[model samples]
Target: MDTQIGCAIKASNELVKNLHRDGFDRGCIATFNDYMTTFTKNKASLHRSLNGINNAKNGTRLYDSIVDVIQIFRNRGEVSRPWILVVVTDGDDNISSRSLHKCAQETSSLFTTKESNNFLFLVGVGDGVNSEKMNEMASAGNFIYIHAKDFFLLELIFLKIANKITTSLSLSLGNLTVGDHSASWAEVQRHRNLSKVAIDYALLIDVSASMNSRVISSNSVTNLNSVITHATRAIGQSFDSRIINTTNVALLASWIDKKRGNPYNFSDLPFEFKLIHRASRDGFGNDKFHNNCDNKGPTIVVIKVKYSGEIIGGYNPLEWRCVKINEWSTLLPNNHDFYIDQQRRTSKSFIFSLTNQTISRVTLNNDAIIWSRNKGPCFGLQDLCITNNFGKSEQRSYENRIINKKNFEIEEYEVFQVIDKRPRFSIFYFIFMIFMGIFKIIKFIFMRLFLGIYWTCYIVYWIIYWITYWTVITLICVAGIGLIVSILALPIILYLYLEAEIAWVILSALFIYAPILGLIGEYLVI
Candidate 1:
């Protein structure tokens, strides 16, 4: 038992260091089975004492162990940092007074009081382990339930859990709305991929004559038009000078004529071709973008920006522009429409400075743009791929098809591939099992049966309604058909039995009349 604890701790320590995660601080180590020892910071002494420790005498009290850990967190008064509680058990609880539900509630409460980043890991090894109880004891987010038939797999499971924790802590998206903003944090955490991929991007910039003029309301060192134009030009220059010439980049431009709100054609735009190339075709060919990026292996990306005049007031408002990308779209209009700048009272202008990319810009929408020093593809591109698989150019669309044996082929795939990976049993399966078990016990105690009586009554009702109606209707239809057949055969029967020529004449008339009557019945039903 002590060896397992030492092995898990050692593996976790090594993983944290190897993954470049913050080092872990040694916390209290305690064991409980309807009883608990005081938590000690001296992990070395605790491990040394583990060998002498004997098997717990009583039944496994999983709840008590969880409560002890929660108590330790409360005593330490450290609510800001992340804490993890790992419970390893081999059998079900039998003698503990504390119910499993109580333990889960306490676990949830403990984490709720903190920053909500705490974790719980329940490892159940060997047969007779109660998987349901273990799952119940684990709090939702970052918590995991691992089941292994042997102790040998425990070490591997611990290592996997440690790796997950390390990866989660490494990618700190400062203010990016990924996990915390979602309704289900556990689901969001499951699909998070921190890996970076190259991107093939398109940039469309607005460079109208308005960009060269000063703001209508203010005096500034630089015109609102020049700020965006220079900033965009600089961005284009960086892409051309810093990036490889073979990089897949489609540049387009939109412009305004002398009239306000009147957009100009790409050819009429008065801009240097060196800064940006005009789009050759309307509705940019998504197919060609992927083809150009195939050799380079860059994720597909597109961005369109429109400068809609200047924002009236704010700390960093002058250079604001409405930007839309394939991954996300924002209408950052250059005006105070969402909220009035109460601080300025009257609308005032802030000088636009495009030097620092990290300097927070003021826009109607409070979205922050992450600028990379490497001038890599937009970071939001990663979010799009992780959440929606939006940038996988190799993925074939509905229009894409293959001909096999000179025949057209249709291919189908799972929509939510990530969610589909998780297997689920029908809820009715559990309900049936639980209900049957409880009903048997109730019948045994009360000397009265409920299910059997209910089933008998239901069967009797079904026979009275459905069976009687179907049987009577079937008999009536069979009789009617038999009567018609017998009536037609009567003439033939008389001719054989009576030995009369008149019987043959009656036989012909009977056959003709039977057909006419049948046709009349059919027409009436229709």
Candidate 2:
């Protein structure tokens, strides 16, 4: 056997040992190359079968082997316990007669049965393996796919699978210290009496007298409510019109829990706009701003105008940094656009007034944004510059002015880091893209083939035409030379009969005429 197959066998033995140790009662072993065979469920017999795998075959019939195992399970009748089928291979399927799609359909049908508790895992090892096809098959088959760089990692992969199986079967209490657990609400409802059930509860209570006192006055609560309402409206207006519906507004409003007195926690937001910095909670200092917002890419700054209750903010696609003057000057020589006080260019940066429903994008690409240690968030040349808790707005480098006020006091401002929360690839989308890619590849191959044939035929035609022309010219020259020789020989015979020296003259003339006639025929052909 080859070294790779040997290592794989060793790993398989390790997997069997670990699964047996982990309280697994019964399991079967199967091996595949040109043909596949499933050994008896007896642990000792399976071990012997694994040890006896000395002949490493040349072909991998992976799909056919999986189907055979599935057929065996089908023939075994109904299974009372959960069954797992792990298929490990180090190479692509080269000898499988069953198509991948057909095999996938068969595997997926196993889960459609109400009594079926089957789990399939595809483990691919080695660099030469086609991981994409394996993953696709796994997805279509509704199974998990794990990739290992080499056979050495197979033991760990199998151990993980075993652990997953154990965990799925066992009761989970989640993190005990965090006091959070996962339980089906339907299951909880099925219980007869909640009070009769013994449960452990940990309650944190404040013993101080301040806990009994009403710290926030009724007027302050009213103002807080108004601010929250304005902020919620601003958030709703900030997004696209399609997403500004009532459901989204409710989701955005839920970011702040009024009952808990927590203003910023966007864990429930459908999109990823995490509130990273809140001026009221984190403090309204430039140092606090930089500490929370620096190097946190693509932040959205929302400000509530003090008395007017107008909401205005800017979006900075670049990271916010507090560069010292000396440090800034050093970078200036290397990069002309790298400035801490003057400007930073980004076409994506924009200032907006959510209250006015106006979005003003950057007009001057060279001077789109500015960063300063003393400023909170600045855009353009004082288009919207927030210094400490106060800010100013003007129509400088941006397309339109966001606010009419030259200076405004900030009531509340929040900085949120934009996060990419796009969902995972849909199986249908992945399959569609794969088919499109294949079609394009096939089209390109055919185009290249057609061009190659056309050029080949064109070159062959010129070659054959030249060869025919040269053959015709040679035939004409040879016929002319023979005719001159025959005529000169007759005259020489006659001259010999007369015993005259004119025969030598006629022979010399024949040589000269033959050369002249050949040259004339060559010129006429050209």
Candidate 3:
């Protein structure tokens, strides 16, 4: 009854707004706290009056108020419109003069009998709610009982309810068929008419370690906390806008543990990544991570992608690596301000191309495909003008790429070898080496013997020339002194050699010839 009053007023306000949005503003909202107090068609007056219904009320007059509102709508001919009644209370009725049995009978008779024109929904609040009693007050199949413990979730609850009421959305399996049988029995490819454009999606969240952390909010541009918060908020905003028209948006039933926090946990690590083993069993008797959620859709299990830093156990650069059942697939990090899931092999891993500048939005919807949510100007010293437009655009993905079957396996080794190939060396890098090799061949092998012989011949010729010059000088000086003596004795010697006997002349000629020959030979040759 404390915060329940505020939640009730909020819901009522949303319902009226939704009605006006759907072009059916001809309606009235009545708030029943301790008693059925006000009913008005004016939206502003209705909101003001509803806010006046405070937390002071002890008993919720749920039955009496519903009957009164139904009669009012009936009298005003609002029954002709798509009439619906939503009752939000703590499921406690102490002050109502009308008994629970009488209220149930009247609700069934008046609303259920006229099913086409009337509908009743009862929402219970707090832990001590009597669901069976509330169910009895509701019409057979047109009733829904919603329980909420936290008031923050009232906005989401009201929004969900408002979205449903305004759209009047419904799903049917009878009209859906695969081949010759109904879709319920067969694996149908096309569930709806292909001509009509409609997209339905089921959001599967992993109850892993990080999903439960409360995101610490900040205005700092370079803070990691701020980037994560912005990303998560953007993600939530995308979901609200993109999937509203779609039929199915499945949330994990275990996420309905209202005592813990909102279904969408925006907290940080240690507190965030805790797992849920049993839904209904825990230390506290209350259901914090329990399976009592009213959302009736298929529960999907997701394996979270490992971040590059988390994988290497240190401060690593941005890289996205998908988790594998058998082993961890290591991927190289991209050293840029923006991050893209580069190791995509299957069609499901292909998110929107960041290179496409025309695309104003992108989504990390691929399962097992790792992505860096910790990116943006908000996570840096200043904003970067990256091509992807990081924080300035919407990021979203709506395709159910997994359901459509296609397979292509690309080995990481092949991809790394191709993408990480080293650049080729310059052509002129070995120019000096080439020239040196050519010069060495010319000097050592081809010209070696010719150069040696030429040097030896040149040295011997120089030595002979110097020796001849010195010898000529010595001969001139010595011959000058001997010339005088030779001239005086030449006549006598010559006369003796000619006139004397043959033996005496031969001995004298031989001695002179021997000395001349010996001197010339020793000086020139030795």
Best by TM-score: 2
Reference-based TM-score of each model: 0.31, 0.34, 0.31
**lDDT (10s digit) by residue, model 1, range 1-526:** 2333333334333322232211224344445532233434443544443433334344565566666667776676355556666666666766456676556545544553343345456666556577655543442211345565544344445445444443345464333231221212233233223422111100011111211222122323343333323222212222221111111111111111122343332223433223121112211233332223222311222221112111010121112122223223255454433321111111111111111101112221222122222221212211111111112111111111111111111110011000111235578878998999999898786665666787899999998899768866765676577578777876776665577567666776576466656655654564
User: How many collisions per candidate?
Assistant: 1, 0, 13
Q: Would you list the C-alpha lDDT of every candidate in the order shown? A: 0.36, 0.59, 0.35
Off by over 4 Å in 2: 21-24, 34-41, 114-116, 172-526
Q: What would the per-residue lDDT of candidate 3 be over residues 269-359, giving only the tens digit for each residue?
A: 1111112312112221112212221121211111111111000000001222322222332354334233333222222222111111011
Q: Tell me the lDDT of candidate 3.
A: 0.35
Error of 1 at 266 (Å): 49
* Model 2 lDDT, residue 484, Cα: 73
lDDT for each residue of candidate 2 in 1-526, tens digit (9 for 90 to 100): 2356565666667555544422224555566742333423355755676676665545677788777777766665245655567777766777788988677766655542323244566776656568767755754465556665545445545555544443334354232111112222222222212212211100011111111222222335454444333323322222211111222222233322112332222334434666788887788888899899998988878776676656568888787887655553654465334325657888878777644445788899888878787788999898999888999988889999888889989877788787655576899889999999999999999999999999999999999999988977887777777767767677766655478577666776666567667666776786
Task: After superposing candidate 1 on the true structure, give the runs of residues whose Cα lies further than 4 Å from its correct spot.
Answer: 1-24, 34-43, 49-52, 139-142, 171-526
**Sliding window of 10 residues with minimal summed lDDT for model 1:** 410-419
Model 2 worst lDDT run, 10 consecutive residues? 199-208
Clashes of 1: 1
The Cα error of candidate 3 at residue 60, in Å, is: 2.8
Error at 4, model 3, angstroms:
3.5
